[model samples]
Target chain A: MNEIPVGSSATIVGYTIHNAFTERLREFGLIEGTIIKLLRKAPWNGPIEVQYGHSQIVLRPDELTNIQVKRMM
Target chain B: MSDELPQNPSLIALVGSPNCGKSTIFNALTGLRQKIANFPGVTVEPKTGTVKLSGETSVTLIDLPGIYSATPKTPDEELTISVLKGTHANITQPNAAIFVVEGTNIEKSLFLYAQYAKLAVPTIVVVTMIDAIKGSGGVLDDIELERQLGVPVIGVVGHRGIGLDEIREYLECGDFQPPLLADNQVFTGKSTIEDQHLWAREVAREVARLPEMDSFTRRFDAVLLHPVVGPLVFLLVMLIFFQSIFTWATPLMDGIEAGFTGLRGYVEGIVPAGIVQSFLSKGMIAGVGAVVVFLPQIIILTLFISLLEDFGYLSRAAFLVDRIMGVFGLQGRSFVPLLGSFACAIPGIMSARIIPSEKDRLTTILIAPLMTCSARLPVYILLITAFVPNSLVWGFLSLQGFVLMGLYIIAALSGLVIGKIFKSTLFKGSKLPFLMELPPYRFPAAQNVFLTAFNRTKAFLTSAGTTILFLSIILWAMAEFPRFEAPQNASTADIERLQLEHSALGMIGTTIQPVFAPLGFDWKVTIGVLSSFAARETFVSVMGQMYSVDVSENNESLRVVLQRSITLPAALSIIAFYVYALQCMSTIAIIKRETGSWKYPAFAFAYTLLLAYGAALATYHVGLLLTS
Candidate 1:
C-alpha cells in the first residue's frame, strides 16, 4: 500500500474504530464514504485535524491509520 | 426495570438551558460540598452535588449543562439529551427533574419544559427571580401556571435566598407528571420537539404573567445588545475585564511572588549554596511562583465572567453577536466558549459543548484557543510592559492595551474566519442556524460564583500545575545540560541563572532564536515561547527562569526584573506570538480525543503554527520599521 502524504484529500473507505470511541463517533455521524481533508500532522504524530462534514475536527492519528482514504488531486 | 436494581439513592437533576439559574438552584439544594468537573472528554461537565433528604434518603443533585431540548444537536446540549435518556455510562435510570426557568423569559423556556415532560420524570418548574418582577409591574399567577401545566410550579428569588425552600419542597414532593403538550398544542415532526411553539406559548401564558423589567438592566441591555452597540459593549466589557486583570491582580500577584520568594530564601538559608538551593529556588520557587502569581488574574476573570453570565447579560451579548457570528457560519452560543477562551482555551474548548451543531461546535473548539486567555496574559504583560511604550493611540486608545485587545479580537475573528473559510472551501456546508433560549436577567448568584472560582482555581493548581511542572522540568533540562562554569556570586540567584544560561538547556533557546528572530525575539524570548508550548502562562515563568527573578506573598513582583530589561517591540512580538501560536499541548490532546481522529488535530497544529509564524513575522518587521 502506498502511503499518501497528508494534505491530500481522500474518501474514507473504512475505519477500525475503538469500541468506546467508535460508539462515540457513531453518535456524531462519523462513518463510511465521508470525504475528509487532512490538514496537519502534529509533531508528536499523536493526532490529526481534518475538515470533515463541514467542520474541521481533531482526532487521534492512529484512528485514521486504518480508515483508508484514496488520494484525490 | 430490574427487580435486582441496587437501592442507590434516587437522582434529582437540576435541568435548564444555559443561564436559566439551574446552577443557583443546585447550589441552594446542595451547598459547599458540590463537586464540579468536566464529563469525560467534554469540558461541559454538569455540576453534581449530593444532598441528604430529611427522611434519611440520599439524592445526587446532577446539574446538567443548559440545553434547549431533550435531543441536542451539539455535544453540550447532548449532555442534557444523553443523561435524560440514561444513555450515559454515568447515569443508569430516569428519576426526577427540577426544571429551572428564568422568570423574565417564560415563553422560550416552555419549549424546554414541554420536551422534558415526555421523559416521564416527575418534573417541577422553579421560576427564579421574582423580586425584580414587582419593580417591572409584572405579576405571575402561580396557581394559574400550575393549573395550565398540570404540574406544581414554584417561584424562587435566588439572589436574596428567598423561595429556596419552596424549590426544595417541590423537588422533594415530585409527584407531578404533566402532559407533554396542551390539548391545542400541535406536535412538531421531530419527536423531540413536542410542539416547541405551543409549549413556548403555554409557558408564556401560564408562567410568565408579568415581566419584571429592571429599567437599569433594560437600559444596559439596550446598549449592550444593540446590534451596533452590542459589539462595542462586548469590546468595552472585555477592555474593562483586561484592565482589572492587570491592575487588580498586581497586589495579589506581588503577594504571591513575595511568598514564593520568602519560601525560596528560607530554604536557601537552611540548605547553603549548592544543588538544594538551586533546585529549591529555580525549580520550586521560580517554576511554581510564576504560576501562583497568575492565580489572582484567573480568579478575577472567572469571577466577573460568572457574574455577567449570572446577571443574564451574556445571553443578550450572544444575541447581539449572533449576526456577526452568522457572517462566519458560526453560532451565537459560540460566544460563551470564545469568551472562556480569554481566560484559558482548555475551559474555552470545554465550554464549546454549548454550541448545538457538531460542525459549529468543532469549529468553535478549534478557534477557542485563539482567544487571548489569561494564561497568555502574563506573557503579554511581560513583553508589552517591558518593550512597548505606554502611549495613547489616536489620542484616545491605550496603544499598549489596544494592541492587547487587537490580538484577542484577531484570535477570535481568525478562528471564525478560518472556520468559515474551511466550511466554504475545504469543508463544504452551509452554516447551521443559531438557536438559543435567552435566559431572563437576574442577580448573579454569589454561591455559584464561589463554586465556579473554586473549580477553576483547583483546576489551575492541580491539572494545570501537573502539566506545567512536567513541561518546565523538560524545558529546564533543555537549557540545563552540557554543564558549564557557575559564575561567581554577584548573588547566589545570579550564579544559579548563569548556570542556567551556560547550561545545555540555555543553548537550546539560542538555537531556536534565529527561527524566532523574524518575530523580534532574542534567544531567551525564543526559549520562553518554546517552553510556553506546554502552556501559554509558562512564558512568564520561563522569563523568571531567564532573569533568576524570585518573589512571595509579602515582598515580590514581576515588574522588578521586567521593567528595565525588555524592549517594546520584543514585548509586542512576544504577545503577537502568543496571540497567534497554538502553544497549548493540552488543547491538541483534547482535539485528538474529541474528533476521534489524529487527522484534524494535526491539521489544527500545522495551520495554527503557520498562522502564528506568519503573523509573528509580520509583527516583528513592521514593529521594527515603525519603532526605528
Candidate 2:
C-alpha cells in the first residue's frame, strides 16, 4: 500500500528511488525483502524513523513513500 | 614478545562505521603518539598513531574516516574507498586491519566487517562496547565468534582499557588467520541482501545472547526521541548552553583581564617611557592580552560541545534539526560546522571539509563567519556593558544576557537566509540523503575531551603569538607616530586624541570617515573597524589604545570611556554591522586556501560587506526615527 500505516510492520516489495541520493537507501540496506518496522512518523510529514534488523534510521517521509511495501497478515 | 616478527614497522588500518568507538580505540591504543594530517588531495584529516607492541616492535595505525561501505559517494567516502583499494598513491596497503564492530549493534557492524574481509587483508574483529553490552545482560562468546568468522576476535572497551593487553599481545604476535568466508560469496554478486543479512544474523545468533531490548536505554530513548518533547528539550538545552558561555565565563574572563592589566602595569613601571617600553606594554601586552582573555570562554564552550559529542547527543541534535535546516537548502552535515563557528570561524570553516558535497561545503564556508564567534565576544561584551542596561528583562534573564543571546540568534538566522540565497543562485546541487547512525550513549572519556580543548587552545595561542602580535605592533606604530605638537592648554586626553587624529592612522581614518559617516562612525571608530578586518578581536585592543592611552588618571575602564564617547544609536549600529560583517581576514585566507580560488573569497567579502553596511544603515536610521 502507498499509504503504509505508521507503527505497522511490513515487508519491502522494492524501491522506486529516482535520484542519485536514493542509492544511499540501498547502501544502507533498505533493499527489497527486508522487514521494515515503521516506528513513528514526525509531525508535518517530516522524517520517519524505521527499523530493520538492528539498524534504525530517520528518513524523510517523501523519500519513504517510494518504498513499496506489503503489510504483513 | 615479537622476536620472530619482522623488525620493520607494519602499517595497520583501524576502520569502522561512524560512532563505533574508532577514535576512542585509537586514543587508547596510541596514547599521546598520534599525528593528524590531511589525506593527499582531500581535506579529510587521517589520524596516524604509533602503536608500540613491545620493546621495538611497533605498528603505524592509520585511522580511516567512518563509512558504511566501499561504494564512493562523498569525498570522504571516496578517500576511504581509494585507500582500501590500494589506489591512493601516498598510502601503501595495510598489513592488517583492526575492524571495530560494536557489540550491541552487530547486525549492522558485521555487514561492514564482512565487506572488509573481502579485501583479502588479515583482519581482527575488535568487539567494542563489550562492557555496555554485558551491563545490559547480553553476553558475547569472543572465541566462538572468532571461529565462526575465521578471524581472531578481541572484545575491548576502548576507553576503559579493557582487553587492551590481549589486543597488544595479538598484534605483537603478528600471526592471524584468514577470513572464514574465503569465497566471499555474499557480496560477490552471488548473494542478495537477504543472504547477507541472514549471514550476519547467523553469526550474531551463534555468539551473542542479546536481550530483546536494553530496558533502561529504551526507556530513556522513549523520552529523548519523542516528537513533542525532543525538540523542546533541545531548544532549552541550547539556550542554557549559550547563556552559560556568557554568565559562567564572566568571572574567569575578569580574572584574566585583571592579571594581564597588572602585568602590563608592572612592565611599564620597570621600563623607561620610550619605544621599548611602549612596544612592550601597549603593543605586545595590550594587543595580544586582549585576545588571550577570551581563551577561557573558548575552552568553556568547547568543553560543553565535546561533552555533548562524546555523550552521543550531538548526532541526535542533528536528527532533530535536519528538517529545519534542510529548509535552507542545507543538510544535517552543516550542523557541526555551524556549531564550530560559535567558538571560532577559522576552525569552523575548516570543519566544513566534512560536508561531502562541494556546493554544500562551499555554502557552509561562506556563511560560517556570521555565527557570532568567540572573537566577537569581547566586542559584544564591551558594547553591551557600555549601552545595554544591567537590569533584568523577564525575571531571571538579565538584559545583557538576553541581548547577547539575541545577537547569536540573529547571526544564525542570517546564516540561514544567506545559505538559501547561495544555494538557489550561486551553486546548486542535488541534496544527498540524510542518513546518520545514532550511536548508543556512553560516558565520555575525560582525557579525550580535555585533549580536544587543549588542541583548540594551542591553535588559538599560535595565531595570537604570530599574526595578532604583528598587527598590534603596526597599529601601535600608526597611533604613536609623527609627534604632532599640542596646544599648551590642551588636556592630556585631548592631546592624545589630537596626536591620534593627525598621525598616519588618523589620516587614514579621516580619509575613510566620509565613507562611514552615514553610519555615525567617527574617525576613531573607523580606525577600530579598519584594523579589525585582520582579526575581529583587534577592534577592542585598537579602541583600548585609541581611548585609554595616557588619557585618564581616574580608575575608569575602557568601556566607561567608550560609553562617554559614543551615542547609543552609533553603538547599536556598530553592533548590527559586526553581526553581519566578514571582519576576519584569517577567515577569508582560509576560505581562499580551501576553495582553491580567489573568486569565492572575493565574492564572500563583497557580499558580507554589502550586507553589513545595509544592516547598519537600517539600524541607524531606525534608531534615529525611534528617538526622534
lDDT per residue, candidate 2, B422-519, as tens digits? 99898776556566656666689987787667655665556433555665677778877866888989775676677777878778888989999889
Number of the top-ranking candidate, with DockQ as the measure: 2
Alpha carbon lDDT at B515, candidate 1: 79
Q: Rate residue B216 of model 1 by lDDT.
A: 66
Location of the lowest summed lDDT over 10 successive residues in candidate 1 chain B: B430-439
Model 2: lDDT of residue B82 = 73
- Per-residue alpha-carbon lDDT of model 1 for B480-572, expressed as tens digits? 565566645467567656766777656777876787777777777777777677677767766776767773221135555665565656666
DockQ of each: 0.02, 0.50
Candidate 1 docking classification: incorrect
Task: Give candidate 1's whole-model lDDT.
Answer: 0.64
Q: Which ten residues in a row have the lowest lDDT in candidate 2 chain B?
A: B547-556
| Residue B136, candidate 1: alpha-carbon lDDT | 76
